[model samples]
Target: MNEQETGERDPGSGERVHWSEDGAERSALWRSESGARPPGKLAVADDRMTADAAYKLACEGTALLWRGDYHGARQLLAALARRVDRKPPKEGATPEESFHLYRQARFRRARVLGMLLVPLQISHEGTHSAYSVPLRRAPEVAQACEEAYGPPGEELTLVSLRELQGVLGAHEWRRKGVPVEALGGDRVHPRHGVFSPVRGEYVGLVARAPLPPGEPGSLVAFDIGTGTGVLAAVLARRGVGRVVATDLGERAPACARENVRGLGVQDVVEVVSADLFPGTADLFPRTEAGADAARADLIVCNPPWLPAKATSVLEQAVYDPGSRMLRGFLDGLAGRLTPHGEGWLILSDLAEHLGLRSREELLGWIDGAGLCVAGRLDARPEHPRATDSSAPLHAARAAETTSLWRLAATG
Candidate 1:
């Protein structure tokens, strides 16, 4: 979805399309004020357009409306993907350089491929006139489209094939959940916009790390930047007396709340909306005592591992601009610890390996914040990227180890 995704159009990026609104042909440069809208040059295509021509137009950032067969569009998309994968980036001097370049190339590839468009029929009375597109063998995607984009605003609207694919994928994931071994093999179904904790290494570290010494009934933990509430649920299952999880995104807090409710840990876990921590100067207010007492026996944060700007809302889970969340968590760690209590910082060495951040700078931030590394647990990455020989970043991936640094306040 990247920058092409729906929302306010960048000042000069939008152009009008001529289509019939009533009996007369009218011109409307349609732009979604909000929502995931695909950005590109658009043209209406019937069954006459060939796959080769469609591929060329898509590569040039042109979206084609399918007045064509439904199944044919799917095949054309596959052909376009094949072309994209065939052209790999040239090798770089180091894996780090190669990894960065590979990412850039992949991103552009995705942005272009996403230009393939799908049409939805929006009836005047606010219901779909036909759930199926003009294409043959297309499933009843009306419900899925409505669920993803909300009710259509006009007689017709365009959605990128990639976006619809995401909707369908989310539906499948919601139907059959992802298994989190940390939650005693319980399934955690992630809603879109919420990062799924399928990465076992980090969650494994959270599950296996020693619990701080305290009466079992009095232990409280905070799940900072909680996405799907997987960590919060894991904490609650491990018998933490209370777990408070916070997220600022419109979707994440609700997603986390649902996960907590579904896991039956709603009684022990409270999902709240906050930018980073529960209390911040501009957003939320608390008394000095309130802030002091809110410090928990444990605070856990797994921020975006990469230090890059996220162009879209969804990418926020993978890229943290200027290491904002990571630095914030460290800067506030000492203030939010209960004297003897610990802050569990779950991080990966990927950024350092990628030459994005340094070990000395990270240590300096910790010391500058008056926090010290107490004990650390490390786990090797088990994801496919670690062993994919064909992947450009395989070298960096092989050496990656995610760690949970037990941080304590320095006297």
Candidate 2:
């Protein structure tokens, strides 16, 4: 499942921020997707402020409210990033320690960069509301802001320029869409918060894996935690008759529904708002004679690979604390499968390399769940980060492999 998805409510939507300017006190809506609170201290900054001064203030926990040119604020953010990058954390004693240090550094960097803020204003027309930065040289961002935060409200908002840049980038991706080669070059348009399927090796594994013994039209498959519904759509295209794609939150399900519809797999893929599977009884109820509903002929799950707490909405797609989703899928897999059904667990070995998880533990979980591996397919990491030697955990990533474990219920 992917991580980036929009929420029902924008982050910091109802929060208010206060600051003083020219002997007047002012307040505005404080918006943050990371759920950042209003800065405890605020300072108005403009073209006159030096990048070094702004960086110093940001590091000291004072938010710089930009009253300068919009593009200059971006440049200033970039300069801040350059400064932050100057001091890289020392490598730790082990891969696990290195990973933690890397995460901590990243958290600090985002916080420092996020201290640069901008004011957003909404102007109303006869039947339309538009969002823009009330500063010189501001680009038109109404569409991007609308797509991310919903229709513009009357409240003026203060948003981190870093977050706004993310919004703008997501808007572009949604406009062009990410191409999925396994889907015969079709594109999957990811929403603001919904995780995108930029990694294709996993999807290709699904496309080429041997199907369970049944005609495509006769097989009923369940895609657990379907993020963009990309895998569900892929299953449909591969001939699965009924593909139930389920996700927990509001944004993912909605994003999946839209993508599947666009892919013309709406007939075969059913996007559902659910955790793991829809209510178990509804999906696997007893028949008239007390026989179980025909359990899913094929169950596919691509859960978040890392076992760690998510710091933000986007991280949820990458980190799964305690391997909760992974274990849950394994624990529930056997009960929901047909006698001859197959469950595909798509996962990466990066955790193993990082010493966060061990291979034996994963196998033990499967055995405990009454599942036995029937077959396995493996793919080398093709993502850029895997080979980027400069990456903090490059050793682990370079050695990572994604695998699809074909699991069957143990007798």
By lDDT, the best candidate is 2
Q: Each candidate's TM vs. the true structure?
A: 0.86, 0.94
Candidate 2 regions exceeding 4 Å error are: 1-13, 280-294
Candidate 1, residue 169: lDDT: 76
Give the lDDT of residue 386 in candidate 2: 90
Per-residue lDDT of candidate 2, residues 323-353 (tens digit): 9999999998998888889999999999999
Q: Which candidate is the best by TM-score?
A: 2
RMSD of each: 4.7, 5.1
Candidate 1 vs. true structure, TM-score: 0.86
lDDT of 1 by residue, 1-411 (tens): 111222334356453444432255533334221233444455666566776787777777666666567777777778778877787567546656775777787777776667676765554444534333545676667666554555555445555666667777776676687899888788998876567787988998999899888974588788999998999998998899988899995678988888899999999998889877775432222224335435778899999998887755567888998999999999987888776789999999888888888889889988998999999999999899899987667777888889999999997
Off by over 4 Å in 1: 1-40, 123-134, 151-155, 280-293
